[model samples]
Target: MSQSHTSQFALLTQRRFAPFFWTQFLGAGNDNLFKFAFTVLVTYQVQVAWLPPAVAGLAIGALFILPFLLFSATSGQLADKYDKARLIRFVKSLEIAIMAVAGIGFVTQQVAVLLLCVFLMGLHSTLFGPVKYAYLPQHLSERELTGGNGMVEMGTFVAILLGNVAGGLLIAMPGVGAQYVAWACFGLAVLGRVTAQRVPVSPATDPALQINWNPLSETLRNLRLARESVAVFRSILGISWMWFFGAVFLSQFPSFAKEVLHGNEQVASLLLVVFSVGIGIGSLLCETLSRRHVEIGLVPVGALGMSVFAIDLYFASRGLPQPAVSYTLGSFVAQPGHVRVLLDLLLLSLSAGLYSVPMYALIQMRAQASHRARIIAANNILNALFMIASAVLAGALLQAGFSVPQVFLVTGLLNALVGFYIFMLVPEYLLRFVALLVSRCIYRFKVHGDEHIPSHGAAVIAANHVSFVDAILLMAASPRPIVFIMDHRIFKIPVLGWLFKLARAIPIAPQKEDPATYERAFQEAQRVLREGDLLGIFPEGAITRDGTLQEFKGGLMKILQAQPAPVVPVALQNLWGSYFSRVEQGTAMVRPFRRGVFSRVGVVAGPAMPAETVSLDGLRERVGRLLAA
Candidate 1:
């Protein structure tokens, strides 16, 4: 499927891709919806029973996470051993059964039984986790991976918000009780099944391999596979850290709202809203920020802002006398000095958006083709472990009589520490920094109309590809990192693959080589524009062997017409014959670089042009002149 064929939701109405999106969307929705209802029920309606308030809180938290630790390993293996589409349908069917069981617990008002269901739901999610991440690479093109991940992330967040809002409102409604929640779950499950039916069948990548029934062994196996590539492992670490960071903050929010801001649920929720919207904005900006390929440069930018706001929040809460605990949104809004609290929430979330989107894209790009889902499962297992640890660490602070504000300060400090720890271990961030350092330290490089690249929206970037190092150079040189549309074959090239993986290039090929891809790529490009990203494409389709630009292809015309974003014409010169570029035509062609030395490189951005002017000949002529200059 080409971009034009699957550009729209209607045109993309295919079986392989659509079902997984719906399955994940509905799953996210149900997960949050139920959690919201459960939290409200446990906190407000249920009487104190087998445990103390704090104990119950801890137990509930344990219940929510236990499934991931126990089942994720098995789940990851399952994805590798079976057809993903059929597996998804099976999972949806299981959801229907789980809903029925949940209905009984809700109606009976049995806390233990309800707790069982929470664990069960988590178990369901655990099983689906690996399948969820792995299934996409099978379905979408490399060009579409980041955009598709962005859509899935965006959709998941929106669905989560709606689910949480609905759960809270529904649990309090007359006549519905928990039964209504169960019914909602059932309805969504049915819808998911319908979508799954439309999903194209994805065959098992390794069905012939013997199934590993042992969770511990299988879990280790998956991690070993992921670690085969250093960048892949680092990407998994980045993802795991997100779960850790998320668990730390989200766990503390209620306490922070109650003790620090002295505001009600509404105000606290307002904090959540700002963060969610921020992330949504960031995820959408990936296409624009990344320039339509795998641009992880924003990760550093996101991390920087996250730390700054965390520090600002430390000051924001100072000098304000704590108000009596209130759960009303209005009461908190009326309080003096609560504005900083909201801003803190927004900043944390906005920066989080910058941090996470690229991590997901990186993982998707780097994981091995055959075991992507299992690798994702390994990631989930680590995420569960880190989140559980995050909860315990956060809980220890709360138990030690530390106020929520104090906890925020400590976690903020820890976030900065952990982020630095990971960056030190991986050095992609450091590598990017070094790349920029060398650029600034050694070469006087300049990029024009990068603002034309769109600061907050999506745009098309047509560049002339002359070397294999184009992605690394573009990512390093551009004011905002751009995502490059690339050749699928490049994804398998060793260390280059890691570099490509870190940058998040979307690898593509002609339909003759890969018939069922790039449809999603176009859809993802549209998604980036919607989210405000600068999508970079090589209209010539691949690097020019002759060191000359080739004619543009058909997809750009369709993409530009559909998206209608500004087009940036990028040119590269003197990158040829460098260490990362093509020097010879043999297997031992690549040579190592000198330590701390720099390659002479040049990148220039021409003025922004309309999509109409970004046609095959026009873009080529403009970039040709720029490259020549």
Candidate 2:
């Protein structure tokens, strides 16, 4: 598993990239660890205070979240308007200031000041979110985005769990004290700042970007851009939903550990440790499961696990005795009966991890390049919205007299139902679901030399577009997902558009009617390859009306000039005979012999050719020959 994770880690260890990954990781770690420390101190250690533990818990959570609502707008704009590396350095420096205050508060036992620091850190993180997400497309390719985000998420949760354990252990230390724990956080903050200095310069995407001073209006503008594509918007919703689940589950750990498992806060921290580790594990698994692309086929699968296990957790805890809570980890192990709680914890975190990583990748892959940062800002806004709602929902449920187990049961069942309903309505998840399913369960894919397609970054796939199903078929056929240059009309289809937008397929039109479309398509094609995807284009401009291939258009020439990614010409022979076969077949059933279920979906790839060989007529002639052969 470590070896499998090496490529993902390369993004971190490599000098050009590692600093940003660590900067973001350390910042998140510091944020959660401090919040955990404050929450633990108020809820357990002090036991004397001005307010009840529940009120303090809610206030602490609120303080961290309020910053996202108030400061994300400014931070997101700053990220777009300046060099991200510098902005990150500035943020880390701010952390040093916040941590210094936190250390003073911890030693003085000033809970209000600690909560204030939590709010400040939340504000710091809000500013970092856009920078964190937007920085990647500048450095990594489309292929690397999914894997990269997986590593980020995995690292984050692992850090979170470690910080939780560290906070509890440090405060309870016999010789050491809470002040020392705060100093250790401050030390890590300094380490993060040093790493930030090493991050490569990512120049401003919009140096002239106007700062929207009003958080509400700016947040609204950002969401409007995100909603331009239903698929992109849906991805945002999916991500926000995970945060919703996370906030609820994370907030309930204390009650869950006490009344249900009959274990103390230490066991509570252990449950969190198990869950966070599971999240990191599942996140890393997405790279292998998705084959290193932003394949969101796993989102619904994650949702399934969330709902299934939640229900089972409810059942698992039904009859068990409510043993007295114990602070020592050994007590739960001694009882040997609360193992089910442990399983539920691990499964819930694993599901949450799987749900999140792909959604992050999808937003990056699909958003307009000029406004990608803003789209991520919109995502943060929705995430904030979801998290707030989760808190409200949990409070309402509990106020209505639902037990912790019952709430778990309900949320879990709702997760499954919601997931199934969404997949059924969209069908893209199910389509990719089927594509991946048939891919793994039925036919094994055999790619001879994927290296022929650019290994480190992006490449162009110039194929004779033969049918309406050509792009999706090629998507299913290739080992790597391809960003196709498709017609504007096809992108409007119901189910197909859902996935195309998700795949970030560029749309083109005639230069006369829509110069904007033509210019945008060429620009987007270049961006797609530059972003590290295989840019597939149909030089024919349209599917063949006659059986013979048409003349290759100048679009290919234009794309070659824009970026000059190596071109791999592809040919499709017998694909027109099946249901999708444009060769005018009987329904899907009538087309087959050797071509039964899939028929022979023949696709041939020629050796890499020079961009100099990329002439309109010459490339057309070669593709025509390959089609005939």
Candidate 3:
């Protein structure tokens, strides 16, 4: 997390967060432990008459996911309609019982019994998914949300890594065999439930809301509730697609190491370890890179890396010799071309962590608080659907003669297309990417009183317009998206204009210059504020001809009359002398040739004023005070 924000590690010490965190971590660890143990049993130890090991693996995947499909809707409603802490405790208890059943299956070596345990484990997870995520927003502050999610994500993948290692080692032990794996599962389950008992109470969001026991109708309703917001719904799609992309990479690892890298179980475990570690590191980095804000800018960065690394992994594996038998871990690493594959896996997984944490935080922050659990339930359903699709698609492709590396190639290319579509559909992700890039590279920007900005809801921002880059500067500093109101002429510029359009900036023309454009801009501004979006306007209405405060105009008065949102007064300092500003006293549009590349700039945000108290003179005074500081 940022220096300004509370440490994510500190969260582990808090009563409100620690118990729930451990409960979820232990539960996730238990899931992977049992799952991988089953895989080991099928692959090496046990013989099944009905199906081949490969087919059994596919069936297990389907069986595990099926419960999510069947039970997620009911679980979502339960989270919303009952006490979340109690629901979590109940789910944890169910996990203990399910693991007991799994232990018996392992002791007796009954494949059917083990498979049923997988389905029951899935059912247990489906019930907890909604409650686990929704509980965060209720307990943590908005500024803590990103850091909190980072810790949770980091803990989860680390647990997964440990579980995979433990499961493989336990199942392969000489004397104990599957018995140790079974006992470990039972113990972890019990520990998770015990930890969950200490979680602070989380009251029901909608206690009186009718329970929908029917999975079919409740699932439909859940999806509909998720669809209520375009941003929230699209974020869900981004998350679901990430799972699809990740499942492809992960599910292929065992075969990829054996067939492509010609390595044994150790090498296979190495790949999983690298991937999980990459995700854990990347997840923890999200808080720092985002300055402890739920910055979606990292999403595109992650998507771009996912494709690049996947493509590179394909090329790295090209022309590899096929050894008759798998190599030892040392022999595998000593191979000439293997390290590239490892590096690609690390980078790919890191990007994945960067990609997912923010989307999860966004859903938690943006979704209606009342239905947040159900929204997460909707996300779980979609994730399961995508994972199932990945399995089917990969199976079809492999059956159709696509090699593992080729599948990586195809998925990487598909990521580019899907990522582009998502970014276009929700340009906020793209805009934030640009904002972050510009802030780091183009300017040494600093912000003061940024906490005055609200994390949610409608507000009006009145900033002194100094440069053409003013909106970009403000947008870079702002945690949330701001719909900037720009002069119509500036809006018609080439490359920057396209970026502004993507950001959904409103272009205003002076009434005397263009009446229709002026009317439309104000109308659009009103609509934007009414929808609870941030609307930014330059009180001066245009860039200053001189490096001085221009008179605050009456257009703000018109906007306030139409839609009264809380007015946040802001000022941009030292940008008047920047390259983009009109400080050079020349006819040229830009003077980058005359100015230094990285100039120091600051944005100061004044305390928000009530709608009724905002006026032209008052705003001018407030912005003037901030500018002077």
Best by TM-score: 3
Off by over 4 Å in 2: 1-6, 47-49, 174-176, 321-341, 420-427, 448-473, 477-568, 571-629
Q: Model 3: per-residue lDDT, tens digit, 429-501?
A: 9988888887778777778888888888899989998888788878877778899889877767887899899
Pairs with steric clashes in candidate 2: 142-531, 576-581, 595-599
Worst 10 residues of 3 by lDDT: 586-595
Candidate-wise lDDT, in order: 0.72, 0.76, 0.89
Model 2 lDDT, full chain set: 0.76
For model 2, how does the per-residue alpha-carbon lDDT over 1-629 read when each residue is reduced to its tens digit?
01233577677668766887788778877877787777778877765557678687788777888888887777778888898888889989999999999999888888778878988888888888998999987887766777888888888888887777777677776545678778978988898999899999899988988788998898888888888866688888888878887788888888988877777767777877788888998898888787676777788778888887778888887877764445468878665456776787788778888878887887787777677787887788779889999888998999999998898888887777767766665555655665565445433333222335553457788888665666765565454567788889887877667667767678888989899998998888888877777889888888775557888888888888878877887776665544444554323323434344534444556666787667888777777776776
The best candidate in terms of lDDT: 3
Error of 2 at 310 (Å): 2.4
User: Which has the better TM-score: candidate 1, or candidate 3?
Assistant: 3
lDDT of 3 at 219: 85
- Reference-based TM-score of each model: 0.71, 0.77, 0.96
Considering only N, C-alpha and C atoms within 3 Å, which residue pairs clash in candidate 3? none
Q: On a 0 to 100 scale, what is the lDDT of residue 125 in model 1?
A: 86
